[model samples]
Target: MPPLPPVKASDSRAARLVLLVTAIGLISLNLRPALTSPGPLLSEIMREFGIDTALAGGVTGISLICLGVFGAAAPRLARRFGPERVILALLVVLAAGIALRGTGSFGALIGGMILAGLGIGVIQVLLPGIVKRDFARHAGTMTGLYTMNLCLGAAIGAGLAIPLEQTLGSWRLSLAAWALPALAAAIIWLPQAFVRQSPAPRAARPGRLWRDPLAWAVTCFMGLQSCLAYMMIGLMPLILEQRGDDSARAGLITAIAIAPQALTALAVPHFAARMRNQSAVAIVSIAVSAIGFLGLLFAPPSTALLFAVIEGLGLGATIGIAILFIVLRAPDSHVATDLSGMSQSVGYIIAALGPIVAGLLRDAGGNWVLPAAFFLAVASLNAVAGWYAGRDAHVLQDPES
Candidate 1:
């Protein structure tokens, strides 16, 4: 089929497009910190709350679960109220959740994270659809930009949260500091909610993607890969600290592990778009991650830092591809919306278990090695899923009707 007609827009639409890209970039930066900032400080939080690692896993797991649950609802919400208005509202919700987390109460922190995750969930599901709609011709490049900023956010949080907490003399202030960015994003995004969406990217009937086997393949590929990425985000520092690295050093190692992600996140999508199929890239990327992770988990302590950068490269590419598939596998923006919702909603729920499972294994076995085994297995499964999902085909042509 011929490519969907390019968006023919008024010159004003060009101006709007520039603003939308900026808003999207800023919003993407906000997405990861709410989840990542706490990772570097997990030991401190655990000490303050007197909880074990398994329970600490809940800090990230709860948010992941929220992503799954609320993500499922985003498409319906967008369909009713329109994506822009809903995104503006959710940005406010994200800011509120971040501020709530600064309250320093255990209950408050978990509750805040849930709220933040819910907000993130909805926005996450909706933004890609907007990207696919507005930036159809440059989906891969735009996706790279978005994911690059997202990983940059992750690296910033991992590297700075601990230091910021130390410098501020209060973890609460450090945690709450993230709220400023979220609010700023909201302010920038506010105009979008009111701006013209004429020639809007809507289908008369945007159907569910849950029924298609290809959609499931894409979802599993996204989820299984995320399982590894989020697991590292949620636990890598703690695991390093346990190995006797100081908080600063541990955080630095974790930062190094993820810093490369920002680069790969941008570069991979650009390269993947040139491939015949993503299958070869998928297996190779996952294998590279497994090798790096195994070295980090079992190799000499001195090599951990080196292995981390390797792992980061693999994780970054996988995530970029997973997201690209959401757009590529679907026939158009409408289906992309449902596919994004389904893949992330279901995919993140699957990912939510990664840390919990790793936590349990560590708690029971008294080492990170067991979790390494888990990561390797998940990486293999992710490869298989990616192979199937990477085919050059759409999920199917018709709506449920």
Candidate 2:
């Protein structure tokens, strides 16, 4: 390896900054669809495999767990190989995982999901540091953009999976189609990675993130929000189905619930930046999510779309706000990296419980009401955690401070 180039001030005048930010946003967009797309197709997958609902939900939970587990290791990999190269390599892994998932075997499906989850986890953990390093002054805006693209990707995957499955006459083809985007992102990312490589670089010493209380607070917020989001993605369709909605309508409602997130992703961080403290924003976002969950629990099937939109907006805003916390609460780039690792590592592990608990709840009650209530309770906890985490104070070990 060659010595890393020394950090120097560069011109981030408007035009160049826009280009850099756009590149980063596009790369981040490639991370979510594969993980989210499976949810919309859960019914079909269950039928094909002749499995019960709990098992189908477990498969999604397994993928999330893999994401959390693999995300914890991403920083070390980035340090060793460079962040850009790690991203490119992960994209390849993501593409291969998507392709293998279409194998139509239970074992292959589970294995592919694990691989895909790992790829997503690695990308998610590294992107924050990439943004902080590359757009130091404009980290908030860039974080918002990256988050919006992620939500957009999820919306597209959720909205289109059903249609694609129908058009191709098989869910396998629909699932496999996502691999193209991952491959294209890899190809585009390759040149950027090559252009930015340095032979050697400063080695950051690892620290005890587990011992940090603020770190745990941030992690809890991340985990709790993720739990709500994934639970909705995995179980919303079934919830709608039980209400006497047809399969197509259920899928459409799920899409509607996720689609508004793109707007929230863009708006939340921009607005949150104006506030002195993010605690108020976090409180409102989580409250909104709670309201949306209540709507889903009590609203009639005819009004499900309305509830979905409400939930989508809250989910989107919460995601943007969470990313904002990663930027606002960290003292500097290195601290941001540490915060990223801590939040994502523990957060994801916490998130993995959502699908499992929701699945078990459904199996126990044979209905969506309990699951909705469970999500509401989680959202409440998230709000509390976010309140503490959204403070302007820096973590104790934040070097940048």
Candidate 3:
């Protein structure tokens, strides 16, 4: 028999690329759902388990800390098992985590969240590298799509939690339903692990990342913006409830705010890429979000949804810009990898503090004003950091290295 023709091989490669992109999209859709779903149902979770506000906040904090710590380990896992395999394995674990969380025991809930967080962290760390490898010329577009889907997923997760609970008659069941999507994503991703694998790139040296002022600026911006984002996800529903909204209504309100993020998330990166610098965009986005927070704090309950929309749009753009900075400021792929590791690992750990603080303030003062003030302060700092990071300059290189 004649060997396969070159044209057919090329077509086969094309087909595989399409499948891989599909897999990436499906996986991205799942990342935020697991992270954000608990927020809308958090009140119920707390009541069911008799957990306090701070401990409820600690749920998000626990997951975030795992995201930071396990993310640092993901690159190593990918290198050992291959990126595709690691991702596939992680998806399965994510499914298991989501399922275990529905067991209704506090220990199971926390254990499940830890596993889910680790899975998400590892996959998040590896995805940009995968995009660069597979969609090099179109990395920006692919990443924009990924970010947009992440926002959409968050919106859906937050919005659906209450409705799902009402329909299913159990909050546990509602949470467990998310496992289906994770399983579906895993099935779609399975074929990629069998594809030809490349040797992992050399590990980046950490010395330069530590010395670079610009990298530090970028990291701060990333962390600060993440602080606001996590606060919105973990605390917004509760805040709205404090302002006199019911549980399901508060969840939908948070969903509406996050839903607009999909729009800005899709648009910001593309337009930012065309600009000379992204400083203005970054400032504008954070300012808009901060204003929303102020309104939520001071304005009447009638205006909450309007402020949420404003906040969501700004937040969507803020994060899009933050992720863009990781790619835009890096001098090369190795540097991008190191920058991503530093920003997400350190940044998310910093972000983890936001929810904990919000929870503590809620417990201490029993009001949203202090929490809103905390967010305002963080946003201000993020704006300053963003201004520096968004300047059209690469990270400063080390000398005598």
lDDT of 2 by residue, 77-104 (tens): 8778887788888989989998888887
Candidate that would win on lDDT: 1
* Per-residue lDDT of candidate 1, residues 176-253 (tens digit): 788889999999998889865423445424344566778899999988988898899899898888878998899889
Which runs in model 3 stand beyond 4 Å of their true positions?
Answer: 1-10, 396-401
TM-scores of the candidates in the order shown: 0.94, 0.92, 0.94
Worst 10 residues of 2 by lDDT: 198-207
Between the candidate structures 2 and 3, which one is better when assessed by TM-score?
3
Instruction: State the displacement of the C-alpha of residue 398, model 3, in Å, after optimal TM-score superposition.
Output: 4.9
**How many residue pairs in model 3 have overlapping backbones?**
0
Ten residues in sequence with the least summed lDDT for candidate 1: 198-207
Compared with the true structure, all predictions reach lDDT values of 0.87, 0.80, 0.85
Please give the lDDT score at residue 41 for candidate 2: 85
Q: Please give the distance, in angstroms, between residue 401's alpha carbon in candidate 3 and its true position after superposition.
A: 5.7
Can you rank all candidates by TM-score, best first? 1, 3, 2
